[model samples]
Target: MKRVIRILISYALALVLVIVSMNCSFVNIKADEQVYLSVSKSNSWESEGKYYAQFNLTITNNSSKNLQDWTINISKSGGEISQSWCCFVSDLGNSYELKPESYNKEIKAGENISNVGLIMSFPAETSNINASISPVFETEVKESPNIKEEDSNKEETKSQESVEVTEEINAGDEVETEEIDENLANAALVASRCFLSYADAPVIAIRACYDYMIVLNTEPKEEQETIAEAAVTAAQTASEFATDGDVESINTANNANDDNNAYEVSKDNEPVIEDSNPEAVEDNEPVTSVAGNKNIPTGRLRVSGTKLVDASGNVVQLRGVSSHGLSWFPEYVNESAMASLKADFGINVFRIAMYPREYAGYLTGGDKETLKAKIDEGVRAAANQGLYVIIDWHVLNYNPNEIKDEAISFFNEMSMKYAGYDNVIYEICNEPVGADWASQIKPYAESVIATIRANDPNALVIVGTNTWSQDVDAVVGNEIDDANVCYSLHFYAATHKDNIQNKLRYAINNGVPVFVSECSICDASGNGGIDYASANSWLELLNSLDVSYIAWSLCNKAETSALINSSCSKTSGWSEEDYSDAGKWFMQAIKNQ
Candidate 1:
């Protein structure tokens, strides 16, 4: 009886030991949980209008458990909520009340889930937004399959089955996901607000519609179609909200889009709207005194037009000293010096020659700030003296095309900054040469001119000919398309320059306005390098031909042709008494004009 009892006890002890060993074999796999979210705007604030904000959410799981049910909540402080949508996910099972659109995914252990879409719209005025999401939950964690050492080979088969199930669920979720373009939403908003009333309603509506069309054309084909449909719907809605003026505007807009035949019909039926009283129209037009007129020539230097006309409608003669170096040294062009030029020398215009690249160099390196300040000071000084300032693009080397993009940016900034000012004239290119005149220079010049016109349509733009601006023939050949364009040429008759007679005759006979934009003479032979006597002869001829001329250099001390010496003093050779020869000559030319 004692032996049997001991056997029973031993069996009980063995059972207890087996249970302990099984518990020790069970593994607890820790999950690596993480969440990621990001925010972005479709367009930056620098753009013209409001833009949309987009948010993205991603979840990652790194455990043996399958995460199922989850919730995400997004919040914002500013801006009204416009609309919201989410992607579809299918891991939570039918028991969970998870919204199909918001369900991210059932992330298996060591698997990652991602979703990108509009969580919500924080309207145009919102400045800040915040978002948060809850951790994923599962109905229950399944226990590992019971297997002995002999069943270890089945582990790979079980893993494959889990993967296939997860993939099938993800595939189902993907079908319901939708994407929306933020740009189209912004466009719809703009269209809705564009039209309000009738006196001016039609014109306003047409402009708004045209703007919308431009935006649509720039978008991708699919997006463009979407935007077009939205725009059309918005336009119809706007018509309903509009007053009687609004209806008229809509009709006008529709008429503008009509065929050419319709346009002709409208034109034919339209009554003449001319004023019977010329006095009424004259009252509306701007009037300027003949003496106060300082109209910057609208066309190129070579074109014959009334842009720089005197009171009699003849070509106006502009005699001046080329103060290109003054731009480099603003301190020299003080009130005293400008006073000297105006009161004593009678200089009418100042050609401020600027080396395109070198002048731009002042904006780089440590001298950037200083250079900008100096340039501004110089511009102001010239303006204060009531002088016409020629912003010359002095290109000794480097094709204009090489820096065309930079030039456009520079010119746009300049044109807009001084659009209404009549004192400034933009010289698009300087001294173009070689084949670049046709290939690089002309195109670059045209581009810069267009840029300026886009901002200030009336700004005077001067374009130079090739070969150091000595090729008047080239200037006549490749004419600019713009009526306001002007051609420029440089002259140094002392270097066996082109005959003044030939140049003047060609310019006058061909109806091209010629300005010897730059000239220097040192001797009567016309080949002794910037000779004063030779320059005087050319000047007299230019005066007789009703031509304009700007002396080459106001700040070179070189004997060849020094108007103002290195010390900013008048050259002794011209006039010792008061440095009045150049000044007297300039005054006479102004009087004649």
Candidate 2:
């Protein structure tokens, strides 16, 4: 019985030892399998421009014991993990897996296990990276292997070298840095210089280039301050070569950062200089006592170096053409065609009709592109001909206030472009009538005239009286305050509104410059007019009064007093041969005066 008891005890002891050893083996086991993992990246990166950054990770294991069911985790401070892999282990465990966050490999004692790969993206903007790796083992028992000190040291050195290279690249110290490219830098410099030269203002040029460089460098905070400072210095240097009215130079100089303190120096000295010149202040005095009437056009109309005089002085015949609807008919005013006709005819001025339908297209929810093209083509053609082109804001049925804003924009663009050119004038509103005259037309006309004069002080502006330009009494009553202003009135014998001679007398007597921008022997319905017979009579009266007259139509048609028939053909009414009849008589009248 004693012998049997002893044997049972020994068996029990053996079982306990086996269980304890199994648990101890797993705790002491070190992965013996050799594993290798690496990462790679691409050269191109962002949409705005190109960039390059890649994170590479390599993992290797060398041990005698099998590594089964282990976990490995990797963490990087400034990179995005794009891909990962897992490994499987079998033996001494039912089923185990290794994940990227916890990368684990399973292999036999002498075999090697490695992750497929891991890809990470590091942006160029990132400056640092802190990596952490952890490995958990769950396999057979084995002693931990001693890694070579030299090999560990080599890995640390390589990592430090990689960090240094990344730093250099971020700092733009790399040979491939775009900002530092000699060709690119030179191009930028040349462009900036050209801009400064043209602006004639060093401050403006400097400011523009500074902005450009900021864009070129993508406005990085680190580069902004440095580039801005450099731009200021460059602009100041350029300003030394610019003249007083050299806007480009002034702009460039003003834009320079270094000159910011000196930007308003000239302005500050203006008061002192102005005080010294007493006559200057008097000359600059406002033209009208009305608070906002300072911008009115006030200049004497001169012809042949002599100021135009009325019956009180020498006779001055103004031979003008009523260029009806010329802007609406840009095709007629061709440079090669109309220019020659105008010069040959001795036509000094032309009337422009503003059609509401054409202008409303842009102002009232219509196609802007089409309207702009039409306007640009018409204005440029007339200007190129060197003929005094009138910008007629025609409102046949007045709604002046309704179209005021659009009208102002149109006039401003016109005046600004033609400000210094002597061959342009403005006609505020055409043919306003009835109650619309006082309530809408007058106010609207006043606004437009003010806008144009603000941009072009010397522009000759024509204002029409109410009642379709037939109310001479209303015109003389309202009376424009501007000296350079003139009144426009239309006459058609068929209407019998007033005698042409009587109207002329009233205008001359009142000392108001009268311009017959539109008139026709043929009635509004386009009938009745014995060709030159009636037209010649009207022309005689106009010539006598020295009033400028533009014929009703340059091209003959059913709706007009056709000066030239369709196809530019001389019809029975007025042939091309006869086209010169009215023009010749008008020229003779002017020469006689």
Candidate 3:
């Protein structure tokens, strides 16, 4: 009888503790504004007696965390959406759920999207919706991976600095360390709430903790890390608990908490959604791109005073790789492969080499239409990945006059197809060797130029110079009279030393704009040894000039120029082990930043 009574008492206490612990998460919810949603009637004229109008929805995400499967549910006088643009809207009786489109799907931190417009019909001027409306959003429920090792190293450095400051405070120095430490701690506390995964916690919390702990000058190193780790853990746990709440509610027959339940990230990184029932995303919801630091925004490019200027009138230099003949190596033109180049290798542009005269090239090949379609697909992929694209007409030994008509047709099709896209660049001729810039190549370029300009007048066009694009000096006096025009400069580091760079300098000093369309740190044969000394010299020169350039051949060929191994087959997400010597060098150069 005594043993039974003791077991019952212990069981009762355990249940009470569990209830209190769970309740603490729910009651201690921190709320701030990291995301905001607003809706307004942009253009609306009633279509029928039932009433109809156009509404513009805007979302602003200010946090660094990447969110997916986001939803925006609104009830405005029980309205039904008929058509939507820039987003997929599913009508749910009186409310609606909105998902992002490809272009605006993954809203990067500090980005605002105001293009989501909808045509909906409802009673004219609903009271609460039209008068005053507020919206709420949910962060990603899935746990992100651990922080990168590099990021941890950075945190460890900051933590050490804080310890030094605390030592000063202990020696009768001002409480400066404490103030600095508290500020950082506050920031980290907020970061913890924003990025729930361990990967992101240090991205926010570590540095902050270092600052705060320095003020607590007396605290040991281990103690500082412990305190920071605890704060991050609390925030992460809160997010997981909230997601559970959302999921639990979804499985129920009636979601009674749907209307009143919403979560937000506060200025101090606090959790808003703490309920165990999550709003589950459907299996078919369009997934957003992973948040990456490689995405670059190259606004409209143009030729301005012997340099390439972006839309904001700032001179821009594009660094990237060109493919080694599209038909021969189409495997590397995939989204995943190109993404690795951008994210890991730091390439801003990808040059598509369209050989018009190979054994099975575009013109005489059986895959005529298929080749064109593949080129089109590559351009679309570039745009989707936020990368600039170059459509190179790889003309080596063939005379431009022989295929003038075909070239005209091809440029017309491509220019019209990729019109208005800031990422598209036209490389009219890859190499003009058999003719002079003024007489032979110049005339051929005029015709093709006229064709492309007819379709895309504002696109950046790169014309090949004579002597296989080494004779840029010839284009000094006889420059194209079109807007956004630049001359191509190709070089082989081991073969064409400062001799070629002399001509490059002469052209730039004069009134000629140049773009290094193709280059490699090897001999011209594409299968020679790499010359690092010469390559470093060239790098120094380009950086001084702020010149835009693309490396030679992003293929798996057994050569010095190829970035990857010949046997390795990967489209994207490549590890460092997958790269060759040349590829490794490029990665280091970019990361040297």
Candidate 4:
């Protein structure tokens, strides 16, 4: 077994402190080597003469020995990196140096330390990437060895010998050790924001490598005073290089170990540094805040070739559930709850069903300002959590034409407010029951959609169809020519199965963009026993076609579609014990997915 250890060099006087084995061409785990390095592309895309790729770097320990330290050289032939996360990276002339900080120095064999994601941008001329790792060693620092000045005579002799050995195993890279004696006493910034985000880290861990090793302990009580001070000082020096107002330069790496951070990724557009490393950037700072949200789309979404594609031109599918009318159960419109749905409940998007005509709805007796505020809150929370949010103008029982002025004004307000947010999707009409497609509903859609376009032109818009949004084929016949516009189609598993589904197939094949804005497992009445099997069938169909969907509702209204039971009062953190039968099924489905 073998492993590739990335040993970062600091310029100062010291001796080599490690031993390892090397192989011709590349180092692989076997003999004295115990660690190996490998990388794979998690996502890739290109736009505007630039290519973007997210690569995951994996370091596997395949031997019985405990590996001590390592270093790797990664460079693109004709490109430069925008930034990286999960570790500190220093730009080294032609290549970037990947090194583990104090907290990530140890490797217990067979256990993998993953979640090292790199975001790179390169010119169109660059078409290839190169990566390789150097020497590895088997060792663990059970305790620090004494090297008092009184033993300098012996230490100097050993140090000289160690330095000679380091040069032999270092391959082509130079290895040096600098004794960091500076104090971080006056440094007000976060020392190691990168270290703070380690999995299961509060104090975190750091390992010292090279010829003269200095092991830094995570336990502050151990009181390795000089090493601790050096770790903080070393981190401070690295963070000084953080570029101002550069979102691509800051680190927003969120891993399982950073639960102690207890905050959401920033979605604010104003320039503020989120953090150079894993530390929380002050609110409103332009910082790279990667919150481990793998579901968040990295690029703008649009319809192309009869399917939804992200900015990278890769067909993408989204799956999530919508909230019931925001008139009730407004408690879930905060950051924690929305984050809970994504982190704990496994949802990629949350739809805000803003009813314009219900009892407590916006257009009715409901205070328009209050309703709008709640909608704003929901969108912001979803944004902060790095989840997609759909702002729906729910029009049921009455045509959107009846509330034409109100709908236009509302959409214009929302679109303008969330104009810059890619997570914000606009659903102009929820259900245009019994309206004519090309004459009545189309004109109303034209008015509202035009209003939204006037504010946020690039955002994805979903228009409702006539007769409960089941007429997707109608949209295909007279489709909107806009670039990112999609038609809404809703379904109740127990009610409209094959008929509407068949129409959907025809519409999709004919090139109409469809987004299922609402769905339920029961009849249209929103109550009674669930048709889970039918719902599963619907899900399969949606998945097969790369169609995105929002399951109908996140309320406790005692309905088969309501995810929470009537007896449950908590807005977030609802477990299986708190779910209705339908809720249980949906939760199970999300987990399965």
lDDT of 4 by residue, 1-593 (tens): 00012122221233232323322222464554356666655434564567765555667777675444556567755666654644557788887767754444546567545435465777653333576654344322222233222332332221232211122222242433211211221111222222222221112122212222333322322333433344345444434443432111222222222212211122224332221322232222323332322234555677886788877888877677787766555555655555556655577788988877543457644546656866876676566566788888888744679889988888888888888787888888888755778888888888888888898888888899876687788876687768788888888786556767887899889988889888888865565567777889988888888888887777665457777775665666666677777777766666566
lDDT of each: 0.43, 0.42, 0.58, 0.59
Location of the lowest summed lDDT over 10 successive residues in candidate 4: 1-10
Rank order (by lDDT, best first): 4, 3, 1, 2
Worst 10 residues of 2 by lDDT: 16-25
> What's the true lDDT of residue 69 in model 2?
28
By how many angstroms RMSD does model 2 differ from the true structure? Answer: 33.5
Error of 3 at 301 (Å): 0.8
Error of 1 at 258 (Å): 60
Best by lDDT: 4
Taking every candidate in turn, the Cα RMSD to the unseen true structure, in Å, is 30.2, 33.5, 26.6, 22.9
Candidate 3 segments exceeding 4 Å error: 1-296
Q: Report how far off residue 382 is in candidate 4 (Å).
A: 0.7
Give the per-residue lDDT of model 3 (tens digit) for 208-321: 432232222212222433334544543443343444332110011111111112111222211222111112211122112222222237666898877888878887788888
* TM match of model 1 to true structure: 0.44
| Cα lDDT of model 1 by residue, 24-92, tens digit | 122122223333333332111211243334333444455555554344444434432222323322233
